[model samples]
Target chain A: MKKKILVIGAGSDVAQALSRLRAERGHILWLTARSQEALQPLLADLKVRYQVEALGFVYDAELHSAEDLMAQLPGIPDEVHVAMGYLGNPDRLDDPKDAARILKVNFSAAVLLMNAVMHAMIEKQVKGVLVGISSVAGERGRKSNFLYGAAKAGFSTYLDGLRNAGFSHGIHVMTVKPGFIRSKMTAGLPLPGPLTASPQQVASAIIKGMKKGRGTVYVLPVWSLIMLLIRNIPDVVFKRLNL
Target chain B: MGTPMSALTKISNWGNYPRIEADVRPWPLQTESPQIARGMGRCYGDSALSTHIVDTRSLNHFLDFDAESGLLTVEAGLTFDEILQVCVPRGWFLPVTPGTRFVTAGGALASDVHGKNHHAEGSFSDHVRWFDLLTASGEICRCSRTENTELFYLTLGGMGLTGIIKALAFYLKPIETAYIRQHTLRCENLDETMAGLEAYGHWTNSVAWLDCMAGGRAFGRSILMLGESAKQSELTQAQSLNPLKVHSTKGIPFPIDMPSFTLNRFTVQAFNQVYFHKHPKGSRDSVVHYEPFYYPLDKVLGWNRIYGKRGFTQYQLVIPHADARKGLQEVLELLAKRKMSSFLTVLKIFGEQSENYLRFPKAGFTLTLDFGISASLWPFLNELDGVVERYGGRLYLTKDVRMNPDFFRRTYPMAQEFMEKIKALDPTGKFQSLQSQRLGIHA
Candidate 1:
């Protein structure tokens, strides 16, 4: 079965992995990312390795409007995967501009993109899949990365409500919560080695989770239990912790 | 889809050693510059690694098929696994296949890969008909033996420096059964092993597993396997009914990386001893599918993980028939003196060299061995490379990561010719990879 899929934030490690796996399954990809230039190597490799057609477009998610972006799609994607993220220095969020950019990039922009794509699929009367990769940090606020976590938390909750809205319309909305990953996005970070996942593993989990129609997934499954334990701690004790 | 994102990421080849945080470039070019094409990441070393590359696996698809002619035209990204899934049921099979099914067609051609049948059939390129190449100029040139003959020969095993392979056309050997009539023999020394292989080399396919840990008179103790495609008439009544059907073994993957200490010399030597003694000196013919006969290791998926997080290095070198004995003996003695042994070591005899300017095979004997990554690995491989140079034998570029540039140039006389092709076609030298940079093959 050849699927026509749209992948946004295609330069991200997890997103690239997802696109690679989908292409192996014989899907035609339409990719959009912050920089089309950055996508050249990946698209070239995809072309030579999978022998599948993949078209790339320049799309910046920080736009205040998505009408122009939606207008550029070849057609409504059979499935949509959104993997855009902005993990800024947490301490720098004290600056109002930095904080606003973080929330806009991580929260509202995703909400807008999903809202538009979901409606487009609905208008077409297509029973399509919509997946957005969030993070386990969103399960609870943390002192080290609370701003990004809060934004992800908002995005996760938004997906939950979208899932509610999508059910009657026959659209599947899935929220993926990944733990630590050693992607290009997290290179050089002080992340514990054992806790990190490769982009392929995360991508595999996303495909498996979407196929299973999991509403909100903790990738690797164990993360779900791990988050549960973290979320259950009282704020009194949590506020003192720096993890 | 809405966020500010950066562009670098960490990636590694099959070995999982020296993971690099590098930039990635995807095509439908936003920039006029060219990037290297990488398919399936199956190479055991950095031959396929680079700062940025075109992920060719996404392009795998069958472009055209002639059922009657048994000719297949597939995009470079297509894999033999997928090819067999379709062809085997139709009484067709790949002309050649490596031990793993995951390698992309582009990677196969780029390496000019040889299978267990090399002694009978040649490498993969010998069976190729034509291919559409996306050259450095962005022109789609049709290349074949009779058309663009020079480019065709060079690109067959050009390691993708020639350009991205858009599509390849090749002949598929017709088959009446998916099973192989197999014969196995156990030999107790290098002389016995060589004799056993020669005796069975007349079969369609032959391969030998050597006990690298054995020393003294038992130095090359091995299990020699020979097989022929079981003919329809050769099958039993029940087997004849399902002759054309091919079933893959459902593999159990290694769940997690094993600890590095698990595959040290002590364990490999013990295992090698037991394996050597397991089969008594004799021959047996058995009926089996192509899966076990051609790719026994595929039964356990992610078998590489057994080498652990640091990964292992595979040194596969070939020496000419004239110096086969002396060259192999030198290399084996080096490993024995180091008290180091490999878990997997294979020996095969080549039939003839490939026309592909950069293809590695010649009329020779090739030995492939794997050693887990350790502090002493790189230095040891250098010493081995020095020995290979003395015998005029060459290491397989596809399995190389640490070979010296001097050794590569000395072993592959085509370096000058291949460089000329790159200079003429890609004047700017836009296509690149770590291997090219390491060997200084491209500007």
Candidate 2:
């Protein structure tokens, strides 16, 4: 069945790929972002290049719950994708207001919006799927970016519980733990190709994981084995070595 | 029909085995209700709380047996007892036997049960060849890893929520006799148990019983048991025979539900001490009966009755193998500090990756404890749930009755896929259970 889909972070590279994949799959799509006007050229190109039913809505995960965003829509789409994430500089989060702002936008707001959409799908018992973009840094806290890690950790755990809550119901929850992504999220960071995934690779992997009913997935399957090795590093050595 | 909820009908535990203060009335069977499977009643909670619990005891009939291939086909309701009745006599046995034999074939498949040998053979789901599932639409479809693979995976450890299992076919393990060649190793503490079991896993089917009540120096101390089926030649002339099954004759019914204070620490400690001592020294070599070895608790017809009218709960959790020793220490330390004495506590080693993302048993160390019901228990269990979450571990749904939605989700991340598959099958959600509702599985 061709689904009426909505991409929440339309301009993001991952979001664009997801939009492309769904569009190619013949889904009727409505893409949303912080600047629909900014995304107009991309939107027009998408309609022309992908030939998908496409449109765009402006959204700020900081300001609006997904339901409010969807409420603005002509009607609800079959599935919603939250491709928004911020690996903000933890060092700059020293100011109390700054830290709280990061927490609100990065963690609280995203959770609220995603959950609102989840509540609707679950209550309607609709055959809907919700995918949250999370990072492997959320697996365990690190001194480098514990704040961002904490936010992703909370979001990842929320997605996990949401999955369990929707089990007997029709709702589906997925926790995507991409090891390292080459996107605005990690633009200039020097990352080894073997350890990192491109935005397109991540989007494809996430779709595959959701289709397989995988509860938790590492974007690069190799991360499963890699994480296994990291998880077993004993505390004595782990405490001394800084990753 | 809903279990008649009378003020008199106070239930604290979900196991068919009894504790102190309660009476277990069999749930009335209804034909019109969707097809159903019966669990061992060991589900400590509500995984088996279905509208129509097909009291699998009636379906305990073996349909066919291939002696050479060790493949046995039987009615879904067949229990481990019936399998042993036929297989033990003919040098064959079910590939995997969970802690208790009281569970039915459908029950085992529904829960995707794991046993002491899980590290070696995976779970019961791995051995199952195929099954006849009675879907909500009333279609009897054959599913296995090959046919209807999705249904097969979903049904395995699917918690009987997917469909009513009618009959199942699985390969059996060839056994020399009904006896097991046992080995006993005493670990001074939990870490040693992990090390000892891992070192010996390749050579044996293993399990351990921890001394949860023992505090301080003895905290996390346990006895590790590693064994494989004994060869037929290992049985002596006296052990070579079979005895007629004698049903428990005495019905020691709890005339009246006892007060909650009845199963206090004093009585529980006494029971724990006796249970711990009964295992004898470090180890002993003897030809033990399959009934005693596999299903000792089943001998007591109404064992759960001992817990009184207010039932108890079984809290089981699995920590990643790397952190098992530390996690087990924390759990035991907490239980000891609480002074909660449980009579039955079992520990098993798990290897191989957990297949079902949301299903409970995985590659790690799993701890199972039977605790008497107390008002403080839920809060305490919730606290333990937090501990499990920190370690990225989860509780077994089959044994869980009190985990909240957040805790449950943190525990089983793959629940979404199972949810989707089930939704695809039953859109209207006609097949519903109290557990699915309580855990928000069908909210």
Candidate 3:
């Protein structure tokens, strides 16, 4: 059976990978972004390449309520990929508007959409899967970008709780904690090979993970091991270390 | 009636994994509460981890006994010590005993645990005459091969997923004494070791302790050990002296976690080499204590701390009888490459088809190894899971800590069948555990 997948925040690189992978699966896809024009070329290329149903829509995730936006969807897609994120600068968050914008965009927006999707899922009474892109930064706070880290942390915790709720209901919620992905999100930063992943790698992982129904995964796979070591760092010495 | 307190459920072997947090309520103590059955806390993992534990340890009450018929009835929580305490003195023994005696009558049937003698005796399920189960709706169910056969099969190796076993009626074997006439052979490699095992194919009880430390030329080197109760004619003056007077001090408990690096290649290699050479290679008549003979590791309490706070996981998988040889070779090779040394590695030959399709041991070769949690262990286990799947084998859920849901479903094709039965009995999915929730078993 063919699947119809909807990708939110389709202008981002991770969104590009999500759209491309779903297109390859020959799925019916609806890619959404702030401006339909920004997503048009990719949607056209996807339709031409995979020959599946493809379309683009302009939707601002931060401004719209999930129920209102969900009603606008052509139909409930086979799967929903939420890739919206805001890796805003933590050091320059003096402005109340900037801080709240980041919080609403990264945390509030995704939760709203998830809540609506979950209700739709329960009503439909069908087994479904959801994947959210979280960051290793969310695992624990570091000095580098904790504002972004804290937001991912909150989002990841929310997803965890959601997964617990959906588990018995046959709906799977996965939280993908990518350690360091070389996307627009981390273009200039130096990343170790084993600890880092590419957008394509992350996309492949998500696709494989969803098919496997794995509820949680570390994109690089090695991060679980690295994180194990990090978790054991004694508080006495951990507080003194300079990262 | 309202849902039973979340605290009142009992869980079994397949239920503990990923280490999640939850409230486990004890079984109700009221007169109306259903009678409980306690199993050996070691159904490998969670098979016995539940609320309302029968504490079979106290139920050690013995009922009717027919010495000539080898049929006996005992409470569900009785320990092997208590059983052996009473029965062995009367020249009678359990028909089937798994590796560990720490198990109870309820657990043995719940897991349908097999032993070195599996090829001959099948499993504990095959020995059970009948049992009493406390169903979810608060009913006492008497099930057996002739009665509620479906429930009977479901409870056997059913992981206690069916209902709580309250008591068991099983047949016992007549033995002369507690001593076992034993033999041991040292095999050079995996092939030689399996060859030694197959040579003793008809022995009453047989198992092999492998030296996983040996790699390449000598990997899977092991001591092929076989034994059975000594005949009256074979007992010497000293051996027949006193059967019930066995004595040994309990093992000292570990006070603190060992350093993670304490078990590096050098340390483990030395231990394995020393242990391998210490056991003499000859047929000898020696009176051995049951604890050392069977539960040797049980001597060291709190052994998990040996891996430090990061406990180790035992990855036990069995390749089908057809691909047993080649598959085990590749698996051991992978473990060597990963340098994941276990405290103890074991190899056993199982019997023909088991009653429980999803059960771990089958008509094949089973290998178990303890692995300390490492940064590289997940990917390594994932790779091993793939290999096991390709060979039409599955990881034992009791010991699994890393296998994902997809891998689990593929390996156990009969899973849907098992799940169907469970849902009918537990439509609301009231009883749950970390492993069941993680692997989607409850659904």
Candidate 4:
């Protein structure tokens, strides 16, 4: 059956891959990004390559209210993928503004958007799937990126609560914990090659998870075990060793 | 969404030679002079290498397409692999494609890459309608045959020295199916191979795999493969049902670099002998998927690792038709005498050259040989360059890493003109590459 899919942060690498995959499956796409200029090309590409309707909406998480953003959509979509994220320089935490921006973009704004989308789905009686892309860094805090991790940890928890609340309402919520994605957010980092997943891998995994109604997904299954080990490490030993 | 952070990273081209540290950033950053745009880093040598690299992979996006006319517009960073996935199912195919589908549209244009069908379709630039180039002055200039005519021709094989190619419009050949009707001819020697290629000139695509290690009478023994895009009517029942199915083979990755000693002369000779005898005698015809027909090597991801950590260089040269036989013979004989082994050797015939200033192909025969890097390889290649120059041949800049300025000037002839034009366009010597600097092509 054909479906309507909404992808927030459409200019992101993972969002682009996910949108392309969904478009290939003959789904109608509503993509939102901060810059319509960046989203226009992707929208045009999807329409041409898949011969599907693809519309674009300019959305900035910091500036736009959740209700206003949701109201701009044509109607309730069959699926909503929240892929927005911010990984500001951890070293710049000395500046409170940077720290606050990271937390708001990753956690607060995501929660508000997902909440609005969930209510819209329920009010319209649409048994749709909602996917939130969190990170493995949320599994446990690390010295290198704890601020970003704390925000993602909050987002992951929020999705867990949403999954419980929406189950009765026939809404499926999924949280994706992707480890070391080779994307713009992690571009400069020296990510472990074997552990890192390409945006396509993450996108495919998310699609599979949505179909299975899995509450949480690790893009690479190994990431589950890796996160387990990191989460279990003794506090003293982990603090002594630099990651 | 936001701009990806730039990083100082260690990078190398497909050949993995002359590895260098470069400031690599996503595309469309503020204009920076002396920066080179790199896509997939598929070019075999220093042509794509520079201190600062504008990574164009993120710019991959389809801008427009006309299903009826087969006119397609796409961002420069779009790869042929991505194009085939979308277009093939719609019965459209690239007008001209290099051996590997991993090449980017921009890279293909800058290199003016030729394919087995060059004798029939010319080079990549011939099918291009126009392109938007981000000039050194940060202005987006639309270049085509009529508009920005001089810049258009100069940029086409300009080695990305003219500016960064942002987007392009080109025509795709409409095909009935995704399969190719292939015919293979086994030739016993150089003369037979040349005759076979000439005999099969009517085919849309023709190329030969040479046994470069063969000596004496067996020299240049090859298998000539000819192909014509298979029509729906030509496919078997099973294929005709899904005649437009695109290639979906996820190639196996080459996990680790083979030890340097694994690619020695003895091993290469044995592999060549086995490969030569694997095919039956005389001519054989079969319908094959375009994947295997056009890109057999792409099946082994990072196959260049076979050359080991020291890396290798591909020496590709073309000699005018009149001197092709002699030039090829001399080059092969020299390699044999030197006891140098090239694991992969290819030969093709090219048709009329384009007016594009620096495009590599001309009315000629071209040969490509890959040699692993070694201390003696440089001097040996220099000697081979002399033989090529004597035969009025020129080396492919896309595959070259160490051709001296004098040799480059003598062979390309239009190097000075290209430099002068680029100078007028980029007066501050912006958009220079290691190759341009090495060959004195910059202002």
User: Residue by residue across A141-218, what tens digits does model 1's lDDT show?
Assistant: 887778899999999999999999999999999998888886655643556566678888999988888878888777
Least accurate 10 contiguous residues by lDDT in model 1 chain A: A184-193
Report the candidate with higher DockQ, 1 versus 4: 4
> So what's the TM-score on candidate 2?
0.58
**Each candidate's interface RMSD, rounded to one decimal?**
9.0, 28.7, 29.0, 4.7
Question: How does chain A of every candidate compare to the true chain A by TM-score?
Answer: 0.95, 0.91, 0.93, 0.97
Pick the DockQ winner. 4
Q: Which regions in candidate 1 have their CA more than 4 angstroms from the true location?
A: A1-243, B3-6, B25-34, B236-241
**Which candidate leads in lDDT?**
4
Q: Which stretches of candidate 3 lie over 4 Å from their true place?
A: A1-243, B1-25, B29-40, B44-60, B244-251, B280-289
> lDDT score of model 2?
0.71
Candidate 1's TM-score: 0.69
Docking class of 2: incorrect
**What lDDT would each prediction earn against the true structure?**
0.82, 0.71, 0.71, 0.90
Q: Chain B TM-score for each model?
A: 0.96, 0.87, 0.87, 0.98
lDDT, model 2, position B91: 66
Docking class of 3: incorrect
What does candidate 2's lDDT look like per residue over B1-443, in tens digits? 00122212223325532322222222223345442355455567766555444444444445566777887777676677656654665667778887667678888888778887889988888888989887877788899878988888788888877777877889998766777777777776667767877888885588888777766665666788777777767777777664222223244444554565767677766666676677665666666656666666666656676666666778888888877777877777777777666667788877775555457777888888877666787777877777777777888877777778767765787787778778889776655555776777676
Q: Return the number of clashes found in candidate 4.
A: 0
lDDT of 4 by residue, B1-443 (tens): 12245567999999999899988777766346478999989999899988888889998899999988899999999999999998999999999999999999999999998899999999999999999999887899999999999999999988999899999999999999999999998999999998888888999999999999988888999989999999888899999889998887599999999898888889999999999999889999999999999989899899999889999999999999898999999999999899899999999999998888886888889999999999999999999999999999998989999999999888887887887888888888778788888988863
- In candidate 1 the C-alpha lDDT for residue B173 amounts to 95
Q: Candidate 1 docking category?
A: incorrect
Candidate 3 TM-score, true structure as reference = 0.59
